[model samples]
Target chain A: MSETEALESMVGGEYKYGFTTDVEYEDFPTGINEDIIREISRRKDEPEWVLEFRLEAFEKWKQMEEPDWPNVEYEKPDFENIQYYSSPKKKDGKKAESLDDVDPQILETYEKLGIPLQEQKQLQGIAVDAVFDSESIFTTFKEKLAEAGVIFCSISEAIQDHPEIVKEYLGSVVPKGDNFYAALNSAVFSDGSFVYVPEDTVCPMELSTYFRINNMQSGQFERTLIICEDNSHVSYLEGCTAPQYQDNQLHAAVVELVALEDAEIKYSTIQNWYSGDEKGQGGIFNFVTKRGHCRGDNSKISWTQVETGSAITWKYPSVIMQGDNSVGEFYSVAVTNQRQQADTGTKMIHVGKNTKSTIISKGISAGESNNSYRGLVKISPRADGAQNYSVCDSMLIGQTCGAHTFPYIESANPTAKVEHEASTSRVGEEQIFYLQQRGMDEDDAISLIVNGFAKEVLQELPMEFAVEADKLLGIKLEGSVG
Target chain B: MLEIKDLHVCVEEDPSEEILKGVNLTINKGEIHAIMGPNGSGKSTLSKVVAGHEAYEVTQGDILYNGESILELEADERAHLGIFLAFQYPVEVPGVTNKNLLRQAYNTIAEEQGREELDPLQFEDHAREQLELVDMKEEFLERSVNAGFSGGEKKRNEIFQMAVLQPKLAFLDETDSGLDIDALKIVANGINELSGEDNATVLVTHYQRILDYVQPDHVHVMIDGKIAKSGDKDLAIKLEEKGYDWLSKDASVL
Candidate 1:
C-alpha cells in the first residue's frame, strides 16, 4: 500500500479529526531563527517591546533542549523540519467559499455535533471571514461584548490596541523561561483568543460566542492571555467541541490568566485534536503550558479542561495563590484512546495566609492507551492556615490500557492543612452490562459510565460548554468498544 | 408471553459444572408467578439467564418471547423487547443519577418503539411520579444509582425503575429479601400496581412473606438446578411451615 493510503485509512469512524484540509497555507522558510522571529513580529505590525520579548525568548530557547521527563513515549519532534509560521488564506475565494469544497468529513462531524450549517462553514475555515455575517449574530455578539466593557479579540490585535495591558500581564504568570515549550511559544506563537473583563463589571456571556466567529485555522504555536480586574467575573472558553484538523504534526500553545482583588476567572478548554490510528502513526504531539495566578486578596481562579485528543499530551494547568484569602481550583478530565498517551495534572501553590486550593483530576484510558495524573500541592512558611485538598482518579476501559497517579505534597508551615486522595478503577464488564441491560447499546453504555465517572469535573464547565463537552466524550468513544 | 424449554446453563460454557440443568417454565400474560427456592438453588441464575447476563452461557436451550427465539439477542435487545430483571443486588454506579439512568433507559425503549422521546423536564415529572409509587421522595432521584443507598432503598429503586419502563415481562430476583414489613408492603404494592392484563411478573424469592401482600397465581419451588414441585399460593404457606428439607429428596431426580 502507498504511504498516503495507509495514513488515510488509519482514520475512520473511531478518531474524528484526521482529515487533511485543502486550504492554501503561506509558509515561512522551514526552520527557526532570529530573522524568522523578527519577520513574524513585523508581519503582525507588532510594537518594539513585543519584538524584544520574542527575541529574548528565542535566545533562551536556543539554550534549551526538549525535556523527556513526562511519562510518554513518542518520536521527538524535529524543530528544523517544522515551518515556523503558516497563515492560511485565499484572497479571491471569499464569496461562494461556504458553498463549495469543505471537507465532507469535517462537515459530517460538525453535523453530528449539532453545529449550525453557517457555523459549520465558519468553523471549517471555508472563507467565511466577511460573508458569514449575513445573519449579523456574531456582529451583534461583538457589539454586546464592547458595550459591556469587555475586550475580546485575537492576541495580535490586543498587542496593537491594548499593548499596555498586554505588556503588563503577559508572561507575568508564566514567564518565557518557564519551560521549553513556553519559550518556543513565546518566540513564534501565532494568534489565539485574548479576553479582558473590566473592573466592577461582569462579562455578558461566555467567551465562546466571540471565539466561534473568529475561529480560524490556528496551525501551531498559539498563545492566549486573559485578565480579570478587581471585582470582575469572566468565564473564558478555549478550543471547541469540533474536531481540529491540522497538517502540522506538532502543536505547542501557552495560556496565562490573572485575577485581581475580589475577581473570579473561570477558564474552560475542550481539546479534540487528532490522535492517530490504533497503531499510533502520524498524530499530533501536544505540549502546552497553562498557568493562572490569584494575584489579589479574595480572588479566585478556576481551570476546567476536557482533553480527549492528541497522540501525546503533556501539560499541567497550575495556579499560584499569592494573595491572602485567595482561592484556586483545577478540574480536569483527560481521555486517551487507542495508542494515545497523556501525562497531565495540576499544581497548587499556597504562598499567602488563609489561602486555599482544590484539585480534581480524572483520567480515562481505552484500547492500549496510557494515562497518568501527576500533581503537586505546596505550602510555604508564610502560608499559615492555608488549606489544600486534591483528588486524582483514573478509570481504565479495556484490559490492555493503563492508569497511574503520582501526587506530591510539601508543607513548611505547621498550621497548614493538606489532604490528597488517589484511586484507580477499571470499567468492569459487569458495570457495562448493567447499563446495557437498561437499553443502551455497548457504545452508549461505555460512554454513559465514562461521563458518570467524570461528572465531578464536567459539571464545572459553563452551561453551554458543559453540554458540548459531554457530547464530545460520547463522540470520542463511539465504536471504541465491542 | 415467555417460555423456557429444557434449558441448560453454565458459567462461560464449562461443561463439567452447570448451574441450570434442564429447567422448563412458561407464563402467559397478566399472571404473577412465584419461584421459591433455598439458597444456591438457581433462582437468581434463572432470572439472569432470561435477562441475557454475560456471566451465564446457555449451552442447550431455547428462550422464546412472543413466539420468537430470544437466545441470540443481546441483553439490551431483550430489554427493548420488554424483558426486565430487577437484580438481587443492584450494582452501585457512583456518578450516574437514578433519574438520568431511568430517563435514558425510558427514552431508548421509547425510541425503539417509534414513540416521541421526553425532554429532561418532561422526564422529571414522569420519574417523580414513579418515585411516589415506590414511596420515595423526589430527592431520591438526584442521588447516584444505588450508590450509598440502604438495602431497602435499593430494592425500592429497582421497583421504581420497573414502574418507569413498564416492561411486558419482569423477573424480580429476591426483591423481597432485606426488606422490613412496611418496606415490603410498599414494594408489593408497587409490583401489583404495575402488573396488568398486558404484562406478567415472576417473583423469585426464598420466603413466602411477600406472597402474603401480592398473591401469586402459581408457586414453583426450585431445587438444585431445576424446579421439583409446583402448586398454588397455599404451597408457599406449606413450605414456610415445613422447611425446604421436605423438597430436597425430590430435587435430586434428573
Candidate 2:
C-alpha cells in the first residue's frame, strides 16, 4: 500500500508521515554522560567552550527533577535508555546540492511530506533549512541570502563561521538551568536554524525550517537561535512532523530569539507532529522550550503557533521585555483530541519602563482531550508604567473533554497596569443550528466556527502558511464534536 | 414547501417531558406563516425540529422540505435543502471573520447545487450588497463573527446572513423580540426582500408590529404545544388588540 493508504489504516489516518525511512546509521549507545557530551562535541567539531557548556548543562540536567506541574500523564523519560545522537552516515561528508545526490530513501521521505528537498535556483526570496533525523541535511539559498547580508544557515554552521555571534547569545535568553527538557536540549541538541538580520535591513524574505524525526531509535533534540539587529525585521517559520511508529517518539527542542534596539522578530510555528493512534497510543511526546528576549529599547517579539498534533504537548514560547518601550505579543491555538493533552502558554516578563504585552490564547478540547492555558505576566519593581492585556478562552466540544486556564500575574511596580479576561464555553447546539440554518453541513459549520475562534492566532501566521494551518486543524477536528 | 406531521420532540436526555407534542403544520411556497405563543408553548421547538437541531430528539415526527423528509439529515443537510432559521440568540465566534464565514457558507450550498463558487472579489461584492440590504456597516465584515457585536448588530447580522443565503424555507424565530424600532424594521425589511414566489418563510414572533412590516399570509397562535388558531394577517392585529390571555380564556379558564 502507498504511504497515504497505510496512514489511512492507522488510527485517525490523517497524518501523512506514518511511513519510516530505511537508512542505517551508527547509533550511539542508549545513555547520557560526560563521555556522551564530549563525543557529540567531538563529532560536530565544536569549540572547547561549547563542549564545556554542554557538559555543564548535562550536569545541571542531572540535578534537576522532571516537572510534574503540567496536567499530562506519561512515562518518565529514562536518560540511560535514550541515545544522545543519531545522524545519517552521509552527513559526515559535504552536504548534497540536489535531492538526487542525497540518500534515495531520505529524499523519498521528504517527497512524501510534500517538501521539495532540491534547491531551487529561484526561491522567491524565501530561504529554507531542512533537517532530517539528527542532522542538518541541507541549507538552501545560501548565496542569495548572503548577498543580502542575511545570515541564514544551520546553527552548527553559524558556530563554525560566526563563533563570536553564536557564543555571545547562545543561552542568554533560555539558560541551561531553565528546565529539564531545555537542559537536555542544550546538552545534546543536534542541529536547527540560526538567523541574523543586520542593522536597518528588512531581511527581504521569510526564513523557514522543516524538521523531520526520522531516527526511531533515538529522540531528536534540536536548538534554534535567531537575532535581529537594530532597525531590522524578520519573520521565521518553523514546521515539524515525524514518521509514525508503534513506539511513542520523543521530541525536545529549544528556540531562542534576541531583538535588539528598534528591531522586530515574528516567530510562527505550525506543529503537526504525528499524534498517536486512533486509540491514542504510541504518539509523540513533545516537550519544547522557546523563549525570546527584547534586549534593547523599542524592540518587539511576537510568537504565533498552531498546535494540533502530538499525544502530549508541554511548551510555552515565552518573551522577556527588558528594554524601555519594548513590546511582546503571543497568539496561539491548541487543539487536543482523542486523549491528547496539552499544557502550554507563555510568560511575558516586563523589566523595563513603559513595556507592554498582549496575549490571546484559544484552546479547543474534543474527544476526551484535556487542554489548558497557563501563563504568567510579571512586572518587576523597576518596570514603571508597564501594561499588559491577556485574554484566554476555551471551547469544549464534548462533555468528556476538559479545558482549564491558569493565569499568574505578579506586579511589584505600583504603576503597572494588568488586565486579564478568561472564559470557558461549549460549542452549543444552538450555535450549530444557527450555522446549519445558513446552509452549512456539520463539518463545514464546525470548521467555520473554529476558524473564527482561532482567527486571532491564525491571522498572526504568515499569509502563505495560514490556509494550510486552518485546513490541518479543521480536518483533524471534524466529527470530533459530541 | 414546508410540512411537519405529528412532530414529537423531547430534550435529548429528558424523555419524560415532551417539548413538542404531536404538532402538525404546513407552509406552502410563496406563503408567510407566523407562530406566536407564550413561553414553553413549543413555538421555538417547532422551528428547531424542522432545522434538525441535535439537542431535540424527534421521538415521532416527519419534517418534509419540498415533499422530501429531512428527519434523518444533519443540520447542515437540512439547510442545504433551503431551510433557514434566524435564531432567537446568535452565537459569538471570536476568531472567524464575518465575511470569510459567510462566503464559505454561501459557496458550500452553491457548490452542492453544481453552481460556480465566487472568487474573492465576487464574494466581496456579494457581501457588500447583502450588508447594504440589511443597512449594516461595511466594516462589520472584517470583524470576528459576532465577537463584540451589540444586540442590534447581532440581529442585523442574522438578517444579513438570511439575505445572503436565500433559503427556500426560512424560519425567523423571535427575530424582533429584543430589537429597537429601527433594528426591527431593518430586520423585517431584509426578510421581506429575501422572500420570493418560489420560497417560503415562517415568522415566529410575539407581536403584530413586525408583521406590519412583513405581512404574513397566515398567522398561527400556538398555545399549550398546539396551534390554537390560524387566520389571515388580520388575526395578528386581533391578537395585538387583545392580549394572549384572550386566546387562552376563549379556549379555557386559565
Candidate 3:
C-alpha cells in the first residue's frame, strides 16, 4: 500500500484491508460440550487416541475457569454461544473438479492486500488450512520438503497420517491443562498447520496458516504444533496483514514449538484482526498462548510479532530455555488505537547453565487506547552464567492514550546477569515541526517518527512481513497524532 | 528573495507578548545577511516565524518569498517553495538514519521543482557528495538523525542538510554558536561553499567570529524584538567591539 493510503486510513480510523471470499461452508452449531467435541473429532475422522486426547482435555476444561487477571476490561465470551468448528464444505461431490480450480477472487483479495503475485500462487491454500499444500508449484514444494523428510500439512491430517510424530510432540510445550484458553483450544480446536523438520534438514518452504480459517464465523480455536529435530531449521509465519471481518468476536488459538539440539525455529506473526468501530462497540477478543521449548543444548527459538488490531488482546508468546547454551528471543511491536486494549509481552525462562535470552518490545497507543508491555525473565538457581537483556519502549500519540511497561525479572543464580531498560516518549509538536520543516507533511512526519521508534523490533521481521508491518504502522498511527 | 514587511510575531502560548515587534528586512539573491542580537531580541524568533513554526503566531504584517505572500502556508509547504531554517537545536530522531530524511527531502523538493527523483543508489552517491561539503565523515549518513551527536556535529549536520536540499532562502539560526575555532572554520567553509547567486543566506548569530570567515553583504542588529540598526559588514565588527548596550538605547528611542 502507498503512504497516502495509510494516511487516509488513519485519518478515517478505518480498517484498510477487508474483503470477502465467497465459498460454501458447513459449520457446527453454536455452544461447547462433550458432545460437540465428540462430533468435531468424529467429523474429522480422527484416530481413537486423538479423540481420547480431546476427551481428556474437555474434562480438564470443565474444571477450569476463565482467566480474569489480564489488564483488559471486556464482557466474558460465552463459550456456549460460539460454534466449535467451521470449514468449507468437505464431502463427496462437494469438492471442486480440479486442483487448478482455485478461486480467482481470493487471488484478487490477496493482491489488494499487497501479496505478490508469485506468493499468491505459491501460498494459496486459502482456507483454515484445509488441504494445505494442495496444488500448483505446491507439488514441487512438497516434493522438495519430502526430499528432506519435512512433514507439512494440516494438524488433522498430521494426527491421522503422522500419528507418531504428533503423539510425541503435541502438547509437549504447552500442555492441555496449561491455562483456560489453551485447555478450551485443546478440547474443541478447529484446523491449524502442523510442521515437522527432520534431523539435519532445512525446510525448503516457509510454512504459515495463511488466513488460518476461511469462514471464522463463530470463533476460532486453532491449535498449531511445530517440531524441529536435531540440526534442523524451520521458519514459520502466522496470520496476515489483511484486516479480517471476524464476525466471530472471540479467537483463542494455541501454538507450541519444540527445538532439539542445534535446531532453530523462527516464528513470526502479523495479527491484524478487526479492532471494532471508533466507539469500541464490537471487535475481536484475541486470547492465545504460544510457547517454545529449547529441548537440547545449542538450540534456539525466536518469536517476532506485529500486533496492530483486536479490541482486546492477551497473549504472551514465550520461551523456556531448558538446555545449556540455548538461546531465546522475543521481538514485538504492539499498537492499539481507537479504544483498543492490548496487554501482551513475552516470558523467558532460563533453566539450564549458560542459557541466554533477549526481549525487545515497542508499544504505540493512540485514540484513548491502552497498551501495556508485561514481561517476565526468570533465571533459575541452577542457570549459572545465564544472561537476559530486555528493553521496553513506549510511545503515546494523542493525549488520552496510555502506554505502560511492567517488567518482572529474577536472577536466582549468583552468576546470572540481567539488564533492563525502559523509556516512554510522546510524539511532541516540536518533533513533528522538526520533520515538517524538512519538507515532510504532518502524516509523513508522524509515520517517520513511529517507524524510527519501532525500528529495532521491526528489523527482526522477515522481509515481506517487515514491509507489510511498516505500512501497517504507517496506516495505524500516521494521522492519529496532530 | 525574501522580504519581511513590518513583521510582528508572538508565541502562540502567550500571544500578548509580541516577540518580533514590527521588524522589516529585505533579502535579495546572491546576498549574505547577518542578523546579530542579544538574548531575547527576537533574532531566532524571526527565523522560526519565517519557517512557519506552528508554536509562533504572526500577529501582524506578512512574509513574502519571491514577491508572493506565504503567510498561509504550513512549514512543509513553505519548505517545498525552497525556504529552510536550520534550527539552533536540531531534534534527535533516533533509529531514523540521516540519509533517509535527506533523501526524502531531496526527492520531495526535486518532484516539486518538476525534476526527476534519484533512485536509492544514485541518491546515496549524491548524499555522500554533500557530506564532504560539511567536512563530516561518511559514517554521519549512517547514524540516526542528530541522535547523540555533539553540538558541533549537529550544526554541521544542519549545513549538510542545507546542501542536500539546496533551498533558495536559507536561515542559519545560531549555526555557529557552540563551535570551537577549528569546527567553526569547517562550518564556515560549508556555508560559504553552498552560498551562490541563485540562493540567499541569512546568518543569525551573536558574535562576529563566523562573519570573519564568511563575509556578509549586510549586517543588522536586533534589540527589544526589532531591528535597531542596519549597516554593511563593518556594523558586525562595530557591534563586536561595543556590544548591544549602545544599540539598545538607540532602538528604544526609535
For B1-254, candidate 3 gives per-residue lDDT tens digits of 78999999988999899999999999999999999999899999999999999999988999999899999999999999999999999999998999998898889878888888999999999889998888888999999999999999999999999999989999999999999999999999999999999999999998899998999999999998888999999899899899889998886676
Q: How many clashes in each candidate?
A: 0, 3, 2
Model 3 scores a TM of 0.93
Q: How do the candidates rank by lDDT, highest first?
A: 2, 3, 1
Tens-place lDDT digits, model 1, residues A1-482:
22122112222245543334344444557778999889888767789999999999998999999898889997777787776666544345221234343435333433333333344233321111111101111111444578889887667768888999999999899899889999999998876767889999888776642111112233367678889999999886554222333332667878899999999999887676677667786566778999999998999999998888788889999999998999999999999989899999999999989999999999998889999899989999999999999989998887888898989899999999998888888888788777777898888888788888899998998764565466567667776665
Score each candidate by Cα lDDT. 0.79, 0.84, 0.82
Q: Distance from true position, residue A44, model 3, in Å?
A: 1.2
Model 2: TM-score, first chain:
0.95
Worst 10 residues of 3 chain A by lDDT: A131-140
**Stretches of candidate 2 above 4 Å error?**
A1-13, A91-94, A97-100, A120-123, B241-254
> Can you write out model 3's per-residue Cα lDDT over A95-181, one digit (the tens) per residue?
333334445554455445444233334433211223211111112144456777887767776787799989998888999999998
Q: Which candidate would rank higher by DockQ, 2 or 3?
A: 3
Task: For each candidate, report what fraction of the true interface contacts it reproduces.
Answer: 0.70, 0.87, 0.79
TM-score of each prediction = 0.88, 0.93, 0.93
- Segments in model 1 whose C-alpha atoms lie over 4 Å from true places: A1-17, A89-144, A209-219, A240-248, B13-16, B114-122
DockQ of predictions, in order shown: 0.66, 0.68, 0.81
Per-residue CA lDDT of candidate 2, range A223-340, in tens?
9999999999999887788877877778999999999999999998877788887788878899999999999999999999888888899999999999999999999999998889
